[model samples]
Target: MAYKFALCLTLPHNTTKMKKKTIILLILAAIVGLAQFIRPDNIKKYENGVKTEDLAGVPKEVNEILRNSCFNCHSSSSELAWYDKITPVSFLVASHIQEGTEVLNFKDWMSMSIAKQKAVLYYSINKIRSGEMPLSSYILAHPAAKINKNQMQVLEAYLLSISARGKTDSVKLKALERDHKWVKPALNGIAYMPDYRNWKAISTTDRFDNGTMRIIFANEVAVAAIKAKNINPWPDGSVLAKAAWTQEIALDGSVSTGQFVQVEYMIKDSKKYAKTEGWGWARWKGDDLRPYGKTINFTTECISCHRPVRENDNVFTIPLNLK
Candidate 1:
């Protein structure tokens, strides 16, 4: 009689547990079902067409690789899978597409200038090489988007083939020696900072697209921020200067900095330049130190190009740790 009573007590507890689980499962099912009815507002049915012709001069193989891997997210002619249409997941896919297109859209390939196209291609390759492109989450869902070593080599080779290679012109080298004591300010009101040459070198980069090499320098305030590892917001008064020069390739494939091409600066002052994302943007192109842009609105181009790295405080260079 005692054993029977114990079994009866346990039965009710088990039954109650099962009932709670069933209720929870039902609630989840209802939520999922309701989500299906609500689609993302930005999600649109992408046209199932491949516009390979838009990339006219791109090699056939490269075009195929881009179509298979990048076009879906980077172009207007995206081809979506059945699973990508599911709610919540579809919303994420739409966001990725929106962000990807904003950074680099192949649909506008023909519209870009030759130099701009090369720069875009170079930037795209860099992203791919860094394992940042075809985002890990994206590759998990779309296995075909994963680029292999061979595909990467093909892209690199194509870029190198198009890159300008040769000796630098002596005339341009001589032109860089001119005095810059009275350089004019950019149309946006940021004056030329000649003393940036004395700043500490923070990082260096090679621009394969434009066939130039660049050195990034940080002013005293910027350097202090780097040392403290407090560069995300990069405290007010921080200044960074990037000086670019033509790349001179020797017969043995060694590359050296040649004639000075340009120097760009980013000054930080959150309240002072609140309208321009808390940074003063200015660029002086060529040895003559002529300010870039015809009007004050030139900052639009700077903001657009740096938009992809907005998370990095709109700065691209990752400063090396200082002692």
Candidate 2:
């Protein structure tokens, strides 16, 4: 009986230790819960910066380099990876993206003044050349974002080439901006005319890292063709608009889009647009509805991009998952 009583006395010491462990566990659980509740409100302010696939005027070879190394924070196409979903990590990502866009968002290339664009390009070249970009911390997490020597050369060359062209024709490009063709009212034509947001979302795509997200919306006629699975020549009168946004990151580690970036329209007219392969191409940029292809040279430039898909009715909406 005495020995049993002695053993019972030791039980209190174990219970005390158990109580401490339980308290520590409860504190940890509480801390985690509190962390979750204190998350950011995460308002989706506007279309994201601009997506990789949406970068206009960037050549394919250099585009690949940009997509591979610079797109994440620099472009609106930043989609966080699996590791970025953690709470504090996601917070850091969101903060970097917000700051990155403010510094210089490549997605705003077409929207910014040509002079400003040239200046930004030079700044970017300096940063990349000095190993200052793709942030060291960012590179630690995403080694792929590390710009290589060859890619650096290609990017700098492309930027210099564009800068030279801009310097030579800065006046012309600016003047052309006022002379938009396929004339519309002095209002935001493509954005407001039909209100693309109300249209059916035909498909969305990843642009690697040129820094944009592209979501295609189909007008009623085009939606019908998509639903019927009858987009052979994509009957005349069908309209499809692709909206580009700067891809941002939310506190939840999901893609949070920012303000309006760009939108492109493809109107089917087998007869009228036959020369361009049966599609009328037009692009409206920023909130002002700045026309992209203001001149014949620019208009034909659109053809080269779509020329590859000529067999697909001069449309890039083929692989889109329609709903």
Candidate 3:
């Protein structure tokens, strides 16, 4: 009887081990299957019709570092990675590249006005300092992209130098100012209108950073309680207006100047208008609103992501853009 009991216990142990093995194998299979769906895409290599020239004065070390670590996403000629060919991973990689390049494309660096370029570089420094660059998850996969303390210092120094140069380039400054004219309007708290500018509706998004606010304006008729009726008959051509602003809190608990500002228009099948679907953000100086930059950070979609802020009418901490 004792021998029989031992046999029974041993058999169960073997079965348990086999079951654990099966689970692990299944998980691995899922990961592989998901990878197959993420085919690598070389879509970001499009030319922007901008002229490229030698960086005669740029520090070789800084240029090289950026080329290897940042250009992959921040430049138009990003080198495709081996894993980027797979499915889900490819999607994520493509998203990151799109976002990165939109925010600051090195290949299009010459295309920006000097002032805009300086502003972007400053923002880049802040982004890196805040541990937001090379994105932590990205570094995990490509260890070579990791920036050590020394490398970070080099990058910061390079940005400072570039900013100084950018300020002196008046021609570039004028060009950039025109592109980012929305900053002037937002600073004075003016209502954005399509009539004044060739503005059109764009996508929306809901995920906003702290002390930021966004608003979406659309034809009230288009909204038409369609959700209640379980109908979405609104023409996809109907435009949605969107704007976003980032704010900072003063030491006295009052809101300071706008940290960022943006405006765009979009079209969507759904009647809802918010920043979460897709939008853009401006890079405004925290201390002073006059100094500003531009970004395509999907400000339109900011509202949809912040479901928790629906109590505030889907707005975050930013005050209303218009009275």
Mind giving the per-residue lDDT tens digits that candidate 3 earns over 156-254? 878765555545765544544555324343322222333312332222344445556555555433244232331133344344455566656678977
What's the CA RMSD of model 1 in angstroms? 19.2
For all candidates in order, the CA lDDT equals 0.86, 0.70, 0.55
Candidates ranked by TM-score: 1, 2, 3
For model 3 the local lDDT of residue 139 reads 93
The candidate maximizing lDDT is 1
Q: Write down the RMSD of all candidates, one decimal each.
A: 19.2, 20.4, 18.9
- Please give the range of 10 consecutive residues that has the lowest summed lDDT in model 1: 169-178
Best by TM-score: 1
TM-score of 2: 0.43
Q: By the lDDT metric, which is better: model 2 or model 3?
A: 2
Q: For candidate 1, what is the lDDT?
A: 0.86
Q: Per-residue lDDT for 245-303 in model 1, tens only? A: 99999999999999999999999999999999899999998755789999999999999
Q: Return the lDDT, model 2, position 38.
A: 55
TM-score to native of every candidate shown: 0.48, 0.43, 0.41
Rate residue 164 of model 1 by lDDT.
43
